[model samples]
Target: MQGFTIIEIMIGLAIGLLTLLAIYKLFATSEGRRRTTAAVSQAQTAGALALFAIERDIRSAGLGFAGMDPAYLGCAVQAYKRTGRDPAQYSFPLMPVQIVNGSELRVLTGSSTNMFIGARYSASASGVFTMERSNAGFQAGDVVVGTSDTDPGNCLLMEVTAGAGSDITGPGGVAEDDPTVRHLSSGYTSFYTGASVTPERNGGSSVDMLDGGATSLGEGWLFSLGNRPTRNVWRVQDNQLMRYNFLDETDTKSVGVAEDVLQMVAEYGFDKDGSGKIDKDNEWTGVDAELVASKLDRLMAVRVAILVRSSQYERDAVTSAAPKWANGSKDFVMGSGDDWPHYRYRVYESVIPLRNTIWGQQQ
Candidate 1:
């Protein structure tokens, strides 16, 4: 047998090592590509979901049962007075106004246990308020109350009369002895009326207007526009999007609607002349006629751009092999900082009706 030379053996070994290295490289490249594709897919899916949720909510912002309307029952009482002072003489007619507080939104309409008020209610410490319910006794177009009332205390409890025709007396007297005048109670049924049988006072410590006074209108009143303890904020923290609803005084539910969102940016569009355009002079920054009209016409669509990051991108870093996939950039950058990298994402937006805001201009 011929013995192999050292040089030839060394050459053979070198060639074999080279071939192994080539194979390793090929596998590594393929794996990296797979990871990159997965990351991109995940980012897209998450981003799309986030954008969809936001758009849906924004589109329905002033719609559905919560839509902006004079009949929303979320209006604040522009003016109110006790119909009469006599016993069983508690009738307070209110002029309906926009929902000035956020907390009152949930209680505006009566629930299963409460009768509908047909008008909105508000709890504002500030003196400025809109007509919540028309003066109790006036017909449509009848001007009973002045433009606005300065005395915030003038707003008393609201009453739903048993019958119609405004036969109810002021809070100081019995229902105007008219047979048309009907007796009404806040309780759902006689079972809810207690031994005291005292009609609940609006400002009292525990005056229950609905559900047999077990719950008070003021309980949810603190969430009004001006009283919202904290402004609603949307931001990304720890790779997850967070929404904070800060109604400090009310028990309203706050929610974080989405996750994996890297960033969110918003722009307000203004339509001037009822003709949609970016008319700088009529931008939404001011409450001008054009701005107001645009808002009413849904000409002011909210543009929301959201960036979603990949959930599994960082896992490869823990492995011994170098990450094969290249980390890509994101479409949006949060704030003024450009240090962070955003992944694949989608942008979603919609226009909403500023029902009360626009109608106020006509008034």
Candidate 2:
């Protein structure tokens, strides 16, 4: 065979090598860009979805049961159990917009049409609360909240243990003091003795009780009794945004609102003057049950900040540094350990108004 020069063969090999190198570079560049884009998109989508649910519930906060007057939507009470894997998971219950320690949020929702309407509930000195409503739909083990729109400070929440029809009893009072004729201990039955009931108390509705010996729910208090008292809670847990429904007493199931959510922080605005407008000077850097109960009526707005990260590796391995969120002097850092190079981050934030409470102000 005709032999080629050594230089010619070498040149040909070099050209082939160059072409292969170019292809590799192109692939690497494209993959880097793709990962970056995907990370950004994921963060954006997660942020939007989380904010939507929060805003929706925040706007609906303090909403009363259907067919009920809007005037009743007020911050009535703050009560919640603080026992869980995460302390933030449980905080005080505020009727409308309840910010717990400026990190967690709880909103209450309900409809008046489902349960007993216009039913009156009273708490005896012994802590027994009785409800009397014709055709009352309350059942044993049902969670209920007593609220007075005009009197936000006075509210009662409890679990019904007896009665369903015209009479209902709560988890309080001595066993002997219970209405014996109605509660045979074997089962719940409706028995309305309007005449036999003490004149100081109206025996028309069923009676229930809450522990702690606090007579918060007084006679003539408006009733929003229902088996379903929708209490929505939102917080960041284990790098994700989570929601817990207090209404579902049994499950206490937590649903993931968004993934890769790193942190959630908030600021509250108050309408200290009843002017129907939020005042900046009245802003609360943080809030909790005490603040909610003491200043709930004055709260007018809330601003929340959420931080999220990418679910997959999106950065070049050469740089192990995690992404940082620059918010002026305060920079939020995201990512850690071996996967730090694999992710990017973004922040989603919004300032939402408490429309229900604001609307109540206009009236």
Candidate 3:
């Protein structure tokens, strides 16, 4: 067999190299497109899942607290528990949702209260109080809030204890220390076995105000948060949606729900003029100090927006601008040092009605 000419061989090699180059370029472009598509899809899914998880809690934010009168709405609930001080159990605004420092979202939710717990009651600074209805709900380890009849300046928070009432009496009887004081009791030694007294959060008394004295039928009411109270705080951390349970003292760690989550923004939709409807769009948005308690009662709905980013980084700028929600009323903010432009983003927005608030208003 004769060897091919050097020129022909060189030409063939050149053609082969060109073909290889063409294949490489095509493969690279296809891979880039595939990655971009995957990233965008992931972002959409992540945004959706994050919103679902967060809205679940936000929907039921004020379940137990919604039944309170307007006077008690803004009351800074004073609390005490034998266990370590949980922020939820301590002093806090009596609102389902409270936005702090502009970005952090605090969503408060308690277990469903019972008929026996909702009835009118009387409270004393001594922590002893009387309930008008059956004290069947009261139990050891139960967290209870006593709203004062005389004044709503503050609310008393105390945990039901397993300790016996007094030396010469039991619960529902005259206090041994002071024979005149008689607070309602669970009528049992313990509803929850490990119940005890908690130190006042502010080194104050068990109650915020004096005992109601109108034949012990005080306007004040007691709300017992049985074992299943939840105080959840939601925020975006490190491109991940993280949630921390303020009520739970055992696990201090935050649980991450969605990946590639960039930021979450929420707007408050309130009946500004008490029209029972949100007349104006974006009128009084956000849960600032003014949007809580009574104003929060006016909050008919909440508009939540979540911005999610893609896991894939692009060589070229995939996102031209930051995502916006609420008709550009709010936008995702990527602080310094973030390679935000090299990523893709998806904006998910939803207007969630505060059903409890809405239902409360109807009542």
Best candidate, TM-score? 3
For model 1, how does the per-residue alpha-carbon lDDT over 1-363 read when each residue is reduced to its tens digit?
999999999999999999999999999888877877787677677677766755544442322122222222222233222223223222221211111111111111111211112233232222211224432221211111111122322223322222223344757886662222112334212212322232222223212222112232121211111101122334555665555432112122345556666655554454555553545533433222333333333334444556565554433333232111101212333344332332333343333343333433234
Tell me the TM-score of each prediction against the true structure. 0.45, 0.64, 0.80
**What digit string (tens of lDDT, one per residue) describes model 2 on residues 1-363?**
889899999999999999999999999898878877887798889988998888887876655432233333343443332233232223244456667766788777654344233455543334344544331554443444555433544444544444343333456742332331121113232232222211111111222222223435444333444445567878998988999876443224788889878788776777656665755454544555434444456667777778777766644563355433223323455434676555666677777887656654444
- Cα deviation of 120 in candidate 1 (Å)? 7.9
Model 3 agreement with the true structure over 1-363: per-residue lDDT tens digits: 999999999999999999999999999999989988998898899999999987898888776667667777767776544346444345666777776655567787767455332546534434455445445555555566667766677776555543223334558885453222223333423444533434222234544354645555445776665546677888888888888866554235788889988888876788878777887864656647557533656877777888888889888876777778886776677766558888888888888777876776556
Worst 10 residues of 3 by lDDT: 177-186
After superposition on all CA atoms, what RMSD does each candidate show versus the true structure?
12.9, 9.1, 5.1
The local lDDT score (0 to 100) that residue 166 gets in candidate 2 is 35
TM-score of 1: 0.45
lDDT of 3 at 14: 100
The clash numbers for all candidates, in the given order, read 33, 27, 4
**Runs off by more than 4 Å, candidate 3:** 84-89, 113-117, 123-126, 136-141, 161-219, 249-252, 292-294, 334-338
| Candidate 1 vs candidate 2, TM-score winner | 2
